[model samples]
Target: MQTWDVIVIGAGPVGENVAERVVASGLSAVIIEAELVGGECSYWACMPSKALLRSGHARRAAAHVRGTGVHEPTGPGAGPDVAEVLARRTSFTSGWDDSGQVEWLQGVGVDLIRGHGRLAGDRVVEVSTANGTDRLQARCAVVVCTGSDAHVPDALAAVSPWTSREATSVEEVPGRLAIVGGGVVGTEMATAYRDLGADVTMLVRGQVLAGQEPFAGELVTASLTERGVDVRAGVTVVSATRDGGPSTPVRLTCDDGQVVEADEVLVATGRRPRTDDLGLSIVGLTDGQWLDVDDTLRVQGAQWLYAVGDVNHRALLTHQGKYQARAAGDVIVARARGTEVLAGQWQRHAATADHRSVPQVVFTDPEVASVGLTAAVAREAGHAVRVVDYDLGAVAGAALHADGYGGRARMVVDTDRQVLLGVTFVGPDVAELLHAATVAVVGEVPIERLWHAVPAYPTISEVWLRLLETFGREG
Candidate 1:
């Protein structure tokens, strides 16, 4: 039996972070991964997807710089260089190789076992590698960072539709592409392929970016339509049929009696946690369900078993998962050392940020960045909330960013606590402005104290001052 202080299943970002934490704390750890060490974010989801979106967004921003004569011509010549963009995207993915990631793990003193890892029992993991099956024991903790797989409905799965992996890594852009969801992946992919010179259509069963503020969806939808994308919302795909050949087209019939034919269909509905084959039954746990964890990211009924990343179902975002992993690792180290630990909210060993201040950024034409709770959610949770809206175009920095800058900023305040409950920014290049909001929300900075933190006159961040002023006036 191979023994280690900790055993991490799935060497994705979350697993890597957890292993790093444990190893840095003077504990030995081993990472078992069936695929590439860098996992989905490095190869397909975040890196490649952002690579595909950045060029188009930058070019659009440059085009918006029309008033500044320093900018170049703004028409057909201003379009993105598709070949160059794809080459850069390939570079971002390291051509889909993970040698660098493996080297980094080795450098950090984390052992790597290439295989499928499953829970055999408490503190015991069974790894199936090419050589044979190996039983491993974790003296401290067995962390499950197995992540998630893109969900494809049975109806669409039978048609062999493309998920996020195919959409982010495709060599050639299809002449016509149909995206099956209006969520972040679907909307971002729609923008990417359309900018890449494909005839793209999005079939959304609900509003685009349904998680964000309503105006966010409206703005993105407008931007997409302006870019010649057919975004059909409130439309469900009843069935999908595709020819057996790779070059053949796919036919999708919607509930609205609409038939859409595309050279390729991309399904971006949701994700399913990778728990079914993890041998959870051996530990008195069910297979194929989202693992529930406490604030410390330890599985509800298991002391030494921890589930981080998307599998835990705390927050399915990569960054949020990393946060959980860090906390969980700290908790494990503390417990192993028999040290007194505080698992309270906002403590070093608790994932309080996951509950109260998770941040998310949607990289579309006009980006959307949000942190903390929305007004509706705050009110739903019975908090006395106040919402303030500000026009991005009114900000001097925004005017300098583009000719006709259009965007909105909103802040949800807790009337009782006098702190920011949430903040949402929607505009070009607004993703950079999100971290400040995240800090404010996470730290629970009081509204009165926020006023003392002055914003430089001409930056887009001045909108913060405006929002505060508006709230002051209303209050």
Candidate 2:
């Protein structure tokens, strides 16, 4: 058995962050990864999905431009090249090599181990690779950033539904796709497949795809419908059975007793922690695991152990995981030096405050970007809040972006603090508008200060001014 200063398992965003910070602290570290060094988000989750979404957005723009009297068509779907779009997205996400990322780790002075790693005991890791089984103990710490697995609904558990793994790396797009769970994954995949020429149908338990914000569900559904996607909302899959050809046809009975069939079924329900086979029990965890962490991203009782990203079940976004990783890395250094790690320092130093101020963008046409709390959440959290919501129709910028540039943007403010508690923007190019709100929220800037920030005239950013005015706070 060989002992190292630190061993980080799962070389994803979080693990990379942890390793990066640890090496910067002059601490020796090793990263063990069984699959791609960049992990799911790089190849599939965020990068690929966003790439796919960008293609769809381009396609929609082309469609709009065709009838425009002023402009000519350009971009991905300039003349309907689905093949080109898929190929472009595939290449962008893969980036041609895992070796490049591994090289980056080497550049930072971190040892890279290509293998599967599990905790054999506290500060001890058992590795399984082509080289063979070896026991490696960490002289300083063991970190887990294993991430999560795409969820397969129990209704189609035995039917072998397609998980995100298959959806991401399919040799060819399905002729017809039926997706379960209208969350971000499902809707983003819908944008992917629908643009790539698949007959797509999304069955959602809720009214729309992750439509937690006001009028959001209706807006997304409208866009998908415009793109020829069938969105059946408030419909639960009562039964799922595979039948017919070698690939099999999926039969779904809806809650309202409507029957539907599709060539392929995709389970985009959610993701579960990738802790199943990992031997975490030695650290007081079950065969299947949960995120064991305190305020500083430290695994509850394990002095030198930490878990981040999807494994923590906090934000689950790649950015959030990286944030958690940064905290865990700092915490490791602090503990080694006998310095105390404060919980309040979470967001200031790292992404530890994901639950408090996390920004998520749903890359759909007329995109969805939200950060911090929602109006309901702010109220529930006992904040005396003022909610200001504005329609894009009311803004000159939205009207100029495109005809019928209908959208909604909302700001939730803690009236007492006169600061934004949350912000939601659902519309075209609204994705870019999120950072402004995120900065306001994170900086705890007062509404008066925000008004002084001022948006450029005749631009979408002007919506910020309109929203603030709606709340009775204006320059």
Candidate 3:
């Protein structure tokens, strides 16, 4: 038996981070990846999707600056050829090959195996390679970091609906597009396709961009609506039809009994954890499709197995997965050192924010980024919630930079702790602004000190100061 200290399955962000950390901690580990070394986030979810949105964002930004000093032509760098943009994105994400990642793994002394590995028995993994079946033994632990897949609603069956993959990788723009769901994927797709010169309609279950701060959807709706996107809120997509030449049509019957249609349909409702074919059955875990993990990311009741990333149904963001991996790796290192001093405190590193502070970002022109609890959620959790908001129009930077200047910001404060319970930012380039709030909330930074961390003058971030002032008065 070729036994190792740790075996990490699914070499995505979470698994890669875990393996890297383990190597640094002086433990031998191997990363087995079935597909591309970087996994779905590189090719599908974050990298490519963000790249697609970047095209739209850049063009819109340039248009906003047309009459200003910092300005560019309204035309996309892709002018009549999105292949250039797609090719650039593909290259950036994959570096045109997986060899770079494999080399990195090797350089870090983490063994890289390109094969499908599944749990076969106790502390054993059966890797099905082209050569043959190679059973690898992990004397210490196995980490599962397989990510999630786009969930396709049953209402639109037997039709080739564009998931994030197709939307991000499309070679040609359709004449019109209909996006189902107003979540991150759907809204970004709506923005991306529309900027690519498609008439887009967004069908959302609740108000458009629902999970964001209360007034956020209003700003996003105004922006998308201005850009010729038919914004239908409080609606659900009933079904889809595909008697098509190039475009796949989807028809939506909303809650208000409104009917809408479009050239192509994108089902961007949400994602389901990838928990198939990797032999979960062998782990004595057969109840839920997803393998639940305790803190330290150990599989529930199975110390030898850990599940991270979307595989554990935790926070799906790439950064959160990396955090999980780091924690799991430390756990393995501590166990190998025979230091059982702190029994299970490190396990809190495993998807702790999966429930509490899972942040989300929708990269629309007036982007929406939120973390922690929404007002309703905080109230549901029984916190005496006080929400303070600011209109972007009031901030100097927002007013000057936004051309028309339409956006909103809201902070949900837990009155008891005087710390931010949740945050929402909706405006141009606000996605980057989320981290500041995320750190503040995650660190439980007292709101008083947070006031001193100054955002640049004449920059949109200065809205933070204005927002804090507003909160002070409201409270």
Candidate 4:
């Protein structure tokens, strides 16, 4: 019965950005959310997880320095106060409340429908609310920003293993926690729970941080091991059994007939699109499938429909999803107003970075920060590439930052173009060093020109200078 210029199916950061952008461009927008308006990143994934990890990072950083009077705890109990850390994590999520997010939505003049929204054909969204079902129409575009959900293997389903949602929002640290998968979520939770005084075991089917540079996994694996985490790589959980209810311990049987017992188990394997019940079949798209989108984020074969964020499977990170949202929103507006829709690569209305220049940071101890392509990827893309490596500890700033600082920096250069195609930094607090690398790679800054962008002395950022030095300006 009602209509808006745009209808966003989810109110996560990606949906919020798209709605905000469209509303700012003079299009009326409405967001339909079944849960918290702030979505997973705000309540469960990004904010709370980082909050849980930060205190541990600070504690370790202080302990590493000589005059701080802090030392590594002999046992987990000696680390950061668990109660205070959990409370702080809760505070970051506003105690899992979304009133502030709702207020912001209202302030921006975007309407909200609190319900489940599903496609019912072109430009029509049927929302199921507590009162009843209401059919709404979109005058301009229908954007699906439904995001994603954690994929739990069928074998582990009955055991009620924790996902990223449960892991980040847990009120109590388990006495013994077992984590499966060595990707970002698994590694991060392993780091956090270990620091929070839990006996942690990681059963990884592959190397940790496998998507990043191999050295990243090696360094993180070393750090976690030194910190008392039992990391078993190339190990798979064949089955899981929890005999009782929530209070029971979980028993995991591995492929090698080894059994691991834990107070809690977390599965961080992967994510799948949240399109199962969105009525996509009515619109000719399959349910529970990742939507395909063009560079402009328009759904393939559907002119008026757009899919952004994790739903499109292009850069599942929250920040990257927001980046795609911005482009999608602008392009939708342009098309609506009969203006120029700049769809060229790297244009104002294109999400080119999703393919060529995405940046990611894993907040484990000795954080992993990377942007653009890895060396292997660049070569596979058929670029004549040269990889430059530098010992981050050799940089004066890194040494000054922490005693016995250990880390590595790598830059993959396109030899034919003499520009950086990728940069990876694995070390303590190297996350802050990522943006400059992102700019250089995204801007396609030539190595010759980078020589003039001198890094200031005595900071982890000076790794840039060291990396360039290792690469040699002329070469």
Q: Output the number of the lDDT-best candidate.
A: 4
Model 3, residue 411: distance off in Å is 1.3
Query: Model 2 lDDT vs. the true structure?
Result: 0.80
Q: TM-score of every model?
A: 0.97, 0.93, 0.90, 0.99
Q: Candidate 4: where is the Cα deviation over 4 Å? A: none
Q: For model 4, how does the per-residue alpha-carbon lDDT over 37-127 read when each residue is reduced to its tens digit?
A: 9999999899999999999999989998999999978853798999999999999999988999999999999999999999997899999
Residue 232 displacement in candidate 2 (angstroms): 1.1
Give the distance in Å from residue 398's predicted Cα in candidate 2 to where it truly belongs. 2.4
Error of 1 at 107 (Å): 0.6
Instruction: Quote the lDDT for 42 in model 1.
Output: 94
Off by over 4 Å in 2: 62-79, 340-342, 345-352, 473-475
- Tens-place lDDT per residue, model 1, 1-475, is 9899999999999999999999999999999999999999999899999999988887677667765444532344345788898999999999999999999999999999999999887799999999999999999999999999999988798777899999999998888999999999999999898888888989999999998889999999998998889999999999988767667899999999999999999999999998878988876789899999889888888888999999988888999999888898998999999997879878899999888699999998789999999888899999998899999989999998788999999999998999998999999999999999999999999999999999997899999999989998987
> Clash pairs of candidate 3?
295-347, 296-347
Better-scoring candidate (lDDT), 1 or 4: 4
Ten-residue stretch with the least lDDT total in model 1? 68-77
lDDT of 3 by residue, 1-475 (tens): 6888899999887788999998998989998888888888877778888887786577667667647454432333333246666676776677537788888888999998888888888888889887888899998998888788888988864577788877876777777787888877887788777766777888887877666666777777888797678987777766555666434465656657787666678888888777777787776766237778876788888868998888777777888888778778887888878876243432444455666777778788788888999999899999988888888767888777767667788888988989988998877878878888888877778889988899999888898898888888876
Candidate 4: deviation at residue 21, Å?
A: 0.6
| Best candidate (score: TM-score) | 4
